[model samples]
Target: MVSYEGINNARPKTWATAADEWHALAKYSLDAAKDLREYGAKPLKDNWTDEVGATAAAEFAKLADQLEAAYDILLSVNMVADGMTTTIETAHSTMRAAVDLATQYGLEIGVDGTVTGPPPRSRTEAEEMGPYRAQVQDLVDQAVEQVTAADRLAAAEFAELAGQTGLTDPGKALNDLQTHASHVQMQMLANDIPVDEDPTTVRQWWNGLTDRQRKDMMLAQPVALANLDGIPADVRRELRGNGKYDRVKVVEYALANWDKGDPTDFGNNCTNFVSNALLHAGMKEKTSIWGTSDDDSWMIGNRTGVDGVDKRLAYSDSWAAAENNQNFMLEHGGSEVPRSDVKPGDII
Candidate 1:
């Protein structure tokens, strides 16, 4: 006789704060690993004995073990939460179906399908109610199994990760796994699905992103790839929509229309144009990074560099002095204009 409101109010027991705590702990453990590595790397002339190094190693190992345990617990909690969410969803659907059937047939059925009025005394009568009773029981059983499996899977993944910690670079491996988990959690959140505590489910979610999204996600590649020669496929897709790009055509266009003397229209032109373009591309006032020096002054709060308009003006003056009047001629001419009319190399 559970009320719909009560069922609707039900939530997973796992706390996001707890997950954050575990993640923090993992980060600390990673720092400890780095400390251990630095300690071990000290000059041989320091004359470190086997016993001392062994003791330090043992302590680090113990910390790693504790970290692994915490990670496992985190995964388990997430799995249970996921299971609870799934169970609730299934139960709601089942209840809705049952209510619909009852409305259609004009009969009330208990969750266990026991008739309220007139208990069936004879075996023949009980036999007649078997199908309905079985159907309800099956639904309940399925829900229970799913929840239980989620709990078990979470526990298993935690144990496996813990066992591997000692043999592998625990910090690096776990951090990678954590990144993967975060991506999975993001996807689940995006879809309005609850992230389960189970590592398996998290892993599955990580493996399920669209190829483009997956490539674009920072977690998918190492930071070292940032300065690589070619752009990532995901980045190219985002920039050009399709992969077909005429590099020669783009280069030729830029060179043919390049304005060498104008300071505002040269390199600064791209930044100004991009800033405005980004605003027009649906970025709001907060997100948009463009405007005049007063409206969008990049130097409003921070003075790490010179103030915005002043900085540009200073540069223009310096360039004009360096180029011996060539800059002023271009500035007075049609080189500088609004962003829309400017090509790739036009000054702002």
Candidate 2:
């Protein structure tokens, strides 16, 4: 019964704090386990001789096992809490973004995940609103259902470990066998996740993973995970999509197109050249249709079409002036890198 309002209001910071606490507990447990082995278990095994000594050794070994179990239990809790923090944050950000898009289209998502469009005055208005309503509904529904599943999946996992004492006695032989079997099981799961699969297939597989498995798989196979599509939308947004920003293309365009022989290139055209390189590097044009064109309009405006109208008035101000271009970049996917950290093919 989780809803739009629940995710929208959830505090990710608190989850982060909880994760930190669990990590601290795990560290303490690990220290205790290590201490038991070093100061207690080892010494007992090394010196224990005959009947009484052997009896004492057996009891101490059991204690060592319990301490190791305690460390493992705490570590598992820490890992889950850490992973859940990321999951909850992603859910919150995605849900809020969906809500914002819904609002943008004059639609409202109810607390129970219902999409309500604004009342339309005419049949034409109703027709226009239909697609937007459907889009928002799909987005909101997917976001809600995915997050709910993740939450419940994590809850179910936690339930299995509930009330189990971190430091408890368990007489066992399957412990070592269990560990090996679990490793094999996890490896099998990892192998089952297809490599170089179509993005749709990859996304579907990723969506089916529990939150724990997602975190574990990412840690275990980062290179494969990096190649896969459908990473968290917020993380993906930070990247220029599909490796579109190619430095090689930027350099190539710069070398081939650098010239003042054209009539439009009267004098300095550093930003113009940069804009051309950027276009070759796959930066999309933001003409008046999209934005960054308040002064005048030029069809297919940029360096390639700079000669069509007045040179100063022909192109995007962002496509010509260094300052304007920098500002536009900052507003877009670009970041203000420090001078010392600036790399080649980066806008100066």
Candidate 3:
């Protein structure tokens, strides 16, 4: 089972000190080897002017180069491990702060991941603390998620590092790490991540990212361009909607006018709102029983006749009710979509 006890008990400073010593030793050793090759081996070989001496010097120089390279790789690995330790230590402190806040609220988490509480003394206090408790709960949830991510990252990186490289070449180690990171990023981009994330949660996370990061992800992970289950439909619509209609304008109009009635249906305004939205979206009036007075057109206007003129601007009952609107959409250029498959700008 996953636990935060390691974070709570981490002695990162101690590990950091060890890393520093190791890094210094590696660098010092590399410098010493270089010095020995340049000052002792090379000079001695040059003064000898013998084939055996030259061959021995050349071999010593090759050994020195390998030694330097090995030390360089060692230092690189030590530096990375040191940085990771420090970062995780900081993360641990942050999580501890969250736990402190939870303690202040008399909250206790069981091993099974259930939270128990010192119940509020009274209903009034409970009521007052409800919103605050909700906020705290969200904070704790986010903290837990971040901790889990950190654990996974640290473990996976170390495992990959161990398997992929030896200290023979520092540059190769660095290159392999970068290549692996890029491959993992691409895999994440193509995966159905949004389908797994909560729509509100994903939207909030997206909003929190920097603009450059957002652009980078969008370019790198185009698969997320599809409105998945985890992203809010409205958010998707804003990002990917066609410019043929001002969706915001129409939706706002519907919200503002849903209570208002029309001449045809003075008591009901469902279809009127839908029709108004369609009109604002640039849908044109149709002929052949497709008007306010006709049986088909998605219109809303008038109904009475004035002398020789018919008040054709009114809406008909068949075009002003919810069921009628539903049928109209079904018969038109629209199809019924399941809630899971629905995106923004789609008619319900």
How many steric overlaps are in each model, in order? 11, 0, 6
TM-score of 2: 0.50
1 against 3, candidate with superior TM-score: 3
State the displacement of the C-alpha of residue 318, model 3, in Å, after optimal TM-score superposition: 72
Candidates, ranked, TM-score: 2, 3, 1
lDDT digits (tens) for residues 1-348 of candidate 3? 235555555566886787788688778868876886998678868796688778778767766665665565556556545544544453444455445555777676554334556688999988876654544444335434444554455467557655643344545644665445444434433331333445554554454444544554444443354445545465456644465454554555555666665434434455566666767666665545555556676654544644123323555544557787787777776678788655434566
CA lDDT of each prediction against the hidden true structure: 0.40, 0.59, 0.55
Quick one: best lDDT, which candidate?
A: 2
lDDT per residue (tens digit) for residues 1-348 in model 2: 568777677776887788688668766765776777787767777887777776777776667677566655555555555555555565554455557677788788888778888689999999999876766565555555555655664565455445455445432212432233234333333343445445543554455456765655554444345445755564233222344475545655655666534336635768777777777778666667633356332123444555645465556577677787777777766788788654435777
- Report the lDDT of model 1 for residue 178: 47
Ranking by lDDT: 2, 3, 1
- Quote each prediction's TM-score: 0.31, 0.50, 0.43
lDDT of 1 at 150: 42
Distance (Å) between predicted and true CA of 61, model 2? Answer: 2.1
Query: In model 2, which regions exceed 4 Å deviation?
Result: 163-348
The residue ranges of model 3 lying beyond 4 angstroms of the native Cα positions read 110-114, 119-348
- lDDT at residue 166 of model 3 (Cα atoms): 37
